[model samples]
Target: MIEFLNPAELPRARAAGALVAGILRTLRGRCAVGTNLRDVDRWAQAMITEAGAQSCYVDYEPSFGRGPFGHYICTSVNDAVLHGRPYDYTLADGDLLTLDLAVAKGGVVADSAVSFIVGGSNPPESVAMISATERALSAGIAAAGPGARIGDISHAIGSVLRDAGYPINTEFGGHGVGSTMHQDPHVPNTGRPGRGYTLRPGLLLALEPWVMADTATLVTDADGWTLRSATGCRTAHSEHTIAITDGGAEILTLPPA
Candidate 1:
């Protein structure tokens, strides 16, 4: 379902978005070499509960995933990319970790993801991949505004990734989000401009740009939720929830200082 938040509802959406962003920031700060994945999940759970927010993933059971994800946050390290279920693995220096989070507050839901390297180890390839996704995400957001089409956003995002020499995957991408975690208007990472749904005020969209280093193919881990690169190459993902307004797109998810 596609949801458009009226002016009055936008504030609630922003609040949820802020909470999601803050949780991710907190988690990222706490993550380091020797930190357990379960520890990250627990931190997320604590913050969400303290904020009186609901997790969109904890009890999530979709056809593509195992029932009841049973995790507060998605902790994907190195090869793992999307839907990464928290496990017993401890983070290592230079490990590329992606934290994806979603939360519902005041009846509105917001989703966002961030990819960063754990500890002080900076692998050039890993850093490049993560930077590429963030740049692609920024490009997509720049193209979002009233009268714009979803394809425009997708094209902008795809161009960035392609130019960076990364393969694109369309099976899972951004979508309309508000009140619920995922909604209609699937925003592929790549698409032709001047196509798809036209942007309008009050429309909320989650613009995510993710890519694999070598191939576009993905393999599901034994856990049935974590999606990893088919070639086992490092990956990166960046996302944010934005609200379309008369002026342009307003980014709702930003980490607090």
Candidate 2:
């Protein structure tokens, strides 16, 4: 379902967005080479509980995933990309990590994801992949606003990823978010411009741009949640929840200045 937030509910949306952003920021800071994926999930739970907010993922039961994800955050490392459930693995130097989070507060929901490298070792390929996704996410956000078609955002994102020489995957992409997570208007990573749903005020979209280093194919881990590259190539993902506004797209999931 496609859900839009009225002006009265905008504040709640912002609050939820801020909470999600803050938690992600904190978790990112705590991650290190020796950090355990399960520890990361524990930190997320603590932060979400302290904020008096709900974790949209903990009890999430989407058809594509195993019922009740039972995790507070998604900790994707190295080859893993999307829907990475927390596990017993400990991060290693130069490991590319992606943290995707969603939280609900005041009856509104916000989602965001970030990719970064653990330790001081920054592999050139990993760095470039992460940068590409971030740039694609920015491009997608820049293309969004009132009257803009969803395709415009998709095209803008795809252009950046393609230019960076990464394969795009449309199997799972961005989507609308409001009272609940994962709403309508599937925003693919790549598409033609001037097509698809038109943007309007009050609309909230989680625009994510993810890419695999070598191929577009994905393989689900035995856990039935973690999506990894078919070739075991490193991957990266970047995302943010944006609100369509009168001026332009307002990024809701940004850490406070």
Candidate 2 per-residue C-alpha lDDT over 1-257 given as tens digits, one digit per residue, 9 for 90 to 100:
88877888888889999999888888899999899999999999999999999999988998999778999999998899999999999899999999999999998889999999999998999999999999999999999999999999999999999999998999999999988999999999999999999999999999999999999999999999999999999999999999999899999999877
Candidate 1 backbone collisions, by pair: none
After TM-score superposition, what is the CA distance of residue 10 in candidate 2 from its true location, in Å? 1.0
Lowest lDDT 10-mer window, candidate 1? 1-10
Residue 206 of model 1 has an lDDT of 92
Model 1, 40-116: lDDT tens per residue?
Answer: 99999999999999999999998999788999899999899999999999999999999999999999889999999
Residue 57, candidate 2: alpha-carbon lDDT: 93
RMSDs, each prediction?
0.7, 0.7
Model 2 RMSD, rounded to 1 decimal:
0.7
How much is the lDDT of residue 107 in candidate 1? 90
Provide the overall lDDT of each model, using Cα atoms, as 2-decimal numbers.
0.94, 0.94
- Residue pairs that clash (backbone atoms under 3 angstroms), model 2: none
TM per candidate comes to: 0.99, 0.99
